[model samples]
Target: MIEIKDLHKSYTSGSSKLHVLKGINFNVGQGELVAIMGSSGSGKSTLLNILGILDEADTGSYNLDGVPIKNLNETIASRYRNKFLGFVYQSFNLIGYKSALDNVALPLYYQGIKHSERNDQAMSYLEKVGLASHAHHLPSELSGGQKQRVAIARALASHPKVLLADEPTGALDTKTSYEVMELIQGINDEGKTILIVTHEPDIAAMCKRNVVLKDGLIIDDVMINQQRASSYV
Candidate 1:
């Protein structure tokens, strides 16, 4: 449940503004699994940052699950971010000293959820991502795929409405990437809205819809027969 109209974002490049997203219009419906495909400098990362509430667009509108997203104070933005969005990144972003379970439970800690309740919830999410047994492991002990699964578990622990993954498979090998995509596909099948930002064609093909970006604009948008990631996994 995302909607954007004429969204523009730019950054200061010395004396000039480096426009990254120029008049971009985009939409993703509930339960839709969409891939944002782009080469370097395509502004996909910028758009993802805006969608995740990590950055603000320079102009135009963004509505998420019916609420306008713009100019939010840090408090409101943090609340909305916790309430509606869960993010997975290429780096996994796990704390070095935390166990997988602890990493997943960190978000609930911010919500002030009690230790016992949050731990139970985090365990359930880890189970969902097939990482329950590995909950005791640290990121250092896990393989790349295992680390990503832990990240996915952490993202899902909050029961977020939208799962935003940027280059989720970028750091993994091909087979591992497929496995992660398969896991994501299973999550999407259960009615979660998902948007993946990736430059990999195979990764994008696994999604139901693909939006190709070029030079800060969406140059192609198409719905394709979803190639089941399970097939590759």
Candidate 2:
């Protein structure tokens, strides 16, 4: 579902140019659950941004679901992002004033889906994430796990080809983390392509494949026996 080749990225401050991704090559197949593991300055976040089409690589190639991604104007990029990618972040990124349902419906709203249809679709996604009963609750009214669940529902509501999560379990306690992972696993089981960026070993182990990054390079990529998150949950 995704491909990258000879990816290179850099940023400049004053006269110093810091190369964040250097000659990177990577790929994620359809229905694959992959974890991107890296430490600070490893360029995993930069890689994720490129993969999400939020940023452009200085030099390289990225293809998402057979579409080339490069130098897209903001309007085209936004359209492609809505068509191809869904994101879940550590902070949840839900609007403070929007209820869980409204938050999930936001993406559909941007897609020009009518209110009743978007609400219905959002509720179904919330049900999938086990948050249907709390659909009307504000982000502030939910627990950390519940808020994350709402975020996941919001991401799924867009029906994107791939789900990209950065530090999805970073803010929660161990139990809550496992619960969230369990939910993620269930989604992957249904054939959703997922890429999770996590430093936690246990969380990485839950994914089918793990890609380790160091100093802007993929130092290791391996497929392991998937450890079921449900077992941990």
Candidate 3:
């Protein structure tokens, strides 16, 4: 569902330029769960930004579900991002004051969905993530894993083509991390394409494929037997 070919990106800082992605090529198909792994300065995050249309590549091509992605204006980019991409960040990214239900419903609100319909959809997703009971809780009122589940529900409420998670379990304890990964695994089993950027090997092992980046280029890509997080959770 996603294809990126020979993507190159760089950032200018004074007289020197930092090359972040160089000659990178990657593809993800429908119903696939892929993990992107890299150490610091390995360019995985840069690749994520380009894939999300949060940043434009300096050269090369990105095709999202057969549509070319390059240098889209903010308006168009925002629309496409909303329509095609869902994001889960390590920080949770939920508004401190907004209740879980409202946060989950926020994306539909942007699309001008009616309030009642959006709330219904949001509640459905919260139930999907096993967070329906906490719908009225604010981010501060929930534990790290609960907050992450609410964040995941928010991402899913849009029903986007791909869910991009950056270090999704970074803030939780081992047990909680596995619990959250189990939730993610269940979602992928239902055919949602997922691309996760993470540094943890055990977490990456839970995915069906692993792609490693080093020095701004992909050093390895391999499909493996998926490990079920439920085994540990």
Candidate 4:
């Protein structure tokens, strides 16, 4: 459902240029769950930003569901992103004052959905992530795991075709991280395409395929055994 070819991204640093992505190429099929694993400066987040249309690449082509992102204008890109992509961040990006249900309903509100419909959809997504009981709670009232679950629900409430998660478990403890991973895995099992960027090997192992990046380049792409993959979810 997504294709990236000869992707390159660079930034001017003082008088020199720092390349962050170098001719990276990859294809993510519909309903496939994949992981992008890398170290501190591996450019995984940059790639995710580019994919989500939050940032533009310096060069190369990115096609999502047959539409070339490079060809889209800012307004068009924003619309496409809102309609097709869901993002989860390491920080859980929730509105601190909003109730969990309200936070999840925000995207739909922007999409012009009716209040009743938005609440219904948001509640359904929250339930899927096992956060239904916490719907009325504020982010401050919830645990780390509950916060992440609410974030996931917010992402899914958009009914996106692809879910791009960056360091999803970075801020949580092992138990909470595992719980979040299982929720994500369950989403993937229901046919949502998931691409996670993580530094944790155990997290990457949970994906069907793992791609390792180093110094802004893809170095390894491997598919794990089906049984091992099943264990990850």
Every candidate's CA RMSD: 0.8, 0.6, 0.6, 1.7
Query: lDDT of each prediction vs. the true structure?
Result: 0.94, 0.96, 0.95, 0.89
Deviating ranges (above 4 Å) for candidate 3: none
lDDT score, candidate 1: 0.94
lDDT string for model 2 (1-233, tens) is 89899999999999999999999999899999999999999999999999999999999999999999998999999999998999999999999999999999999999999999999999999999888999989999999999999999999999999999999999999999999999999999999999999999999999999999999999999998999888877
> CA shift at 16, candidate 1, in angstroms?
1.2
Question: Least accurate stretch of 10 residues (summed lDDT) in model 1?
Answer: 224-233
lDDT of 4 by residue, 107-194 (tens): 9998999999999999998888888998999999999889999988888888898999989999998877887888888789899999
Which residue ranges in model 4 land beyond 4 Å of their true spot?
Answer: 226-233
What digit string (tens of lDDT, one per residue) describes model 1 on residues 154-222? 898888999999999999999999999999999999999999999888998999999998999999999
Which candidate leads the pack in lDDT?
Answer: 2
At residue 113, what lDDT does model 3 achieve?
98
